[model samples]
Target: MGKKAAMQKSKQWNVKGAMRLTSVFHFLQSCGSGCLVPFLTLYFRHLGLTATMTGIIMASKHLLTLVWRPVSSILARQYDKRRTVIVGSLLSSALVVLILLLFPSAGTKAESGRCNASQPSADFTDGSDFTTLESMIIPSQSNVTVYSVNHTTVIMEQPDDLNSTYTPTLVNSSSNWSRRAIRYLRELKEQQEESLHTEFLGSLKAMDAQHQMFFLVLIVIGLWEFMAAPLEWTADDGLYEYLDFVDATDRHKGVTVWKPLGTAVGNGVVGILVTSLYCRTGTVAEFYSYTAFMILTVPTAALLPLYIRKRDRPTSGGFKALQLVHRNSQALLCAITVVLTGIASSAVSDFLLWHMQDHNATEIHMGISLALAHLSQAGFPLYAGHLAGFLKYHGWLLVLAVIALSIQCLYYSFLWDPWSIIPAQILAGFSTGALWWSVAAQCEDIATPGTEETLIRLFEGLPLELGSGLGSLMAGFVMQKFGIKILFQGISVILAVWSITLAALKWKIPRQRRINYSRLLTADTGEISESESDQEKDWLETAMEDDNQKNNWTIAKS
Candidate 1:
């Protein structure tokens, strides 16, 4: 190839390379969520911030996420997804780094000085008085001789113990002043007046450094987020929403709930194990290991793309292809499960250690309860998804789970048994995951056929986030005042009502839509026009060359 042609081909290769790099970059960047989510509170504590202050800070992030969700989506549609992703991730990273640089470290030490014990006081006399007291105590009978010490008498007094003896001095005037008296008073007074200052700038400097490092980590994370938000919002969110939407309904309910179920269970189980280990070890090392486990789970999130891609692979027949896609769709579901389970497990695990009781029975009771809860949760999505798939009423499953959890919580207020709450936890996981899956699946399906081919997926992530956010905020107040049981009961009633409304709407809404497939398709894929045009141009050029070669051969033969 000529240099120009080679350069053009290289440019095309670079474009492909850029696309591949984007996915990897996004995956690495998203790890920030896992990293920060697990340790925000710990970070604040290290900075000597109070629990209340930490809570406020964390709450601020949640609030921002909620407010920005819709706004971010709108922005994504208005601009290029790639630019948004890169810019958002970078911005967030920068913010995190800046915060690190400015944050104050709490470990600075204060300066202090030593006290002198040998200073003369009002009870003691001048040199003559010391000699008099010595003489009085040593009446001339003993072999003791009172020496007239010269210059100053420097007595290095040790700090007194209770067993030590005490004595007093008496002073008397002599006809002529002794040189010893002048020196003793002058020397001792001079020594007493002198002071030693201990500077502790070293400690202050060390603390500053620590704080800077801590803040830098967070700032780097936040700035990197600037790059992520654009891609996530423009591309991922739509697909996520679609998956979640479909999972919420019967159409895509079969394997969609798997991911959420896995997540709740994974989180609970891992958390329980971590707490137990930490309790035994009684060291922060256990906490670090727990953190490591969470960090390691980032790869799980990245696997979703693989599952989605697998579904898109060529097949021998249309029916078989659909079957394969449907089957592999479960992989995405499973990934979602792992993501949630990992997070919840870590949280619950920490909760156990934080509030564990010393009583032997209490420990056993809590552990058993948590285990049952996790196990029940592990199987919940399977059952819920089955129901959703069979009945074609996935939203109701969410309602059902919510109702069950509320009832159990209410029951706890009236009665007590850790194990009894296990069912509720399981149901909660099922309902939440299934509800989310229903919505996500719907979004994916609803997009026009061509667009769907190029596009983002749907997910219940939004509703889940919204629901959980409300639930968390309320749970805190209810548990603090009315108790855990009352809170659950209240939520159950609310969910039941909502579930009924959704069931009624199932048949009323359109199952399909009529649209210009091409337009919808454009939004689904990467700058579709540019990419498609380039691809078409390349293919046409290749075809034209082949035709020309065929004509040339025919002419030569003739």
Candidate 2:
């Protein structure tokens, strides 16, 4: 009796630990997705990369995910989840840091100082000297060359000097893409610096801020794994991971489906923790802000599992389930948001170009937009969670909002001739909130009854990674190939189809589950306990269904 009681107590403790771990997982996931998606364009633009190259580079990450996420999922099942998470986080972190390292940052302090210095005085002995200096100093991104009388030229090397142009005669066409981009960006940067009052400066600042934010996100994910993975690995998985069927899927094959709601919650709490820390001390508040948003990642990663489960559910007075609902709905909404934003980006950039004489204004405008998008998106989940709580609607509101936003996109695309895409962009800002909510809610709903938590998280992420990858690439391609008008039209069409599909599937289940606030506690115990056999049975049944579904699937991998 004594041994049995002790075992029961242990089980309870494990459940609590699992719950806490899951929340942390969710926060990290959110931060991961939120920081990257809104700012990838800004990062590329800041690097002076053309839209096409930016799209390709962004697509590369998705391509990597297509290979990596599934492999990671398989490993998670076969090995310890904690270890899998840590490995994934660490590897992802290393890759991120490496990618950033590949790019130039503020540079070394000494280098920065030199770059910040003004151009050297030029000899005014001859008029030809001034012309030569203008030609040399205005073109090169790093080194400025000034020509005086008698073929005399002075070269100034300053890495940060926007006025310093390269030796025009020496800029070979054979130079690599990065060098060319860096040169171009520096030129753009110089242009912006000349005019600090224009809207363009804001945009540049927004982009710069976006790039910095992403770098920080990568760092935070690494830190999370460093701090939380070992404890999670050691924690009891009975109430969460074990309950979700760690053994059922073919480790080598098709998609692994499971809910990861707990992970999302964990991420949310982490965000809260960061907020709290910031409240306590202002230092590193931005880092705290970034870490706090970690919650968004879980839903996107586990989208497939959530959709599959959604597919299997009993219809409310049932019509045939809408095939390809997930793709159509999400794609449509996301496309609309991007297209509208693109148009706005163009119109605004153009307006700034025409009206603003200072480059600094352009930089600041871009920076503000980038920052606004991320900060708003970071707060999205909390608002969504609150809405879900009040309305008792899982993700219905988010979907509706997306649809509404798409309509607004159409309004900007069609009716508002001279208003700029600003109005549409204002609406487009809601896309992340809607999509993230949909992803998270879908995971909660569609994942098998008792196994919703694990699968939700697992499936939410992959889709976001994949979707954003495709979206960013497509956005860049469309923007580069066709003007913003065509891009807006394309996005409208995609979103229209998606909305129709969502209206068709239209499964509505009344919210009945009570919020288990106790689940938020970090202890190793919950309010209830169940036998090991029961937990095993729950997992086995879910896995069998999942396997059967996989056998029947014939569609392409999105």
What are the per-residue Cα lDDT tens digits for candidate 2 across 1-558?
Answer: 999999986764453344444444444544443333333344345444555555556555544554555454444444535344544453444333333324543211111222232324322432453334433234433244434444443333445656665542333323464355446546765886565556653533434433443444344434433433332222223223343443422221111111223323333433344334533431133233333333234333322121011123232211111221232343333334333333333332222211221222232233343334345544555566666677566555555655755565455445322234344445543664555556545544333333333433333334444555566567667767885556556665666666665555544322223223242242232222223333334444677889887877734332
Quality of model 1 by C-alpha lDDT: 0.39
Residue-wise C-alpha lDDT for candidate 1, range 440-523, written one tens digit per residue: 444354333333322222222332334334443444444446643454456546545544554455444333322234444435
Give the TM-score comparing model 1 with the true structure, all chains together: 0.41
**Would you list the C-alpha lDDT of every candidate in the order shown?**
0.39, 0.41
| Best TM-score among the predictions, by candidate number | 2
lDDT of 2 at 510: 27
Estimate the lDDT of model 2.
0.41
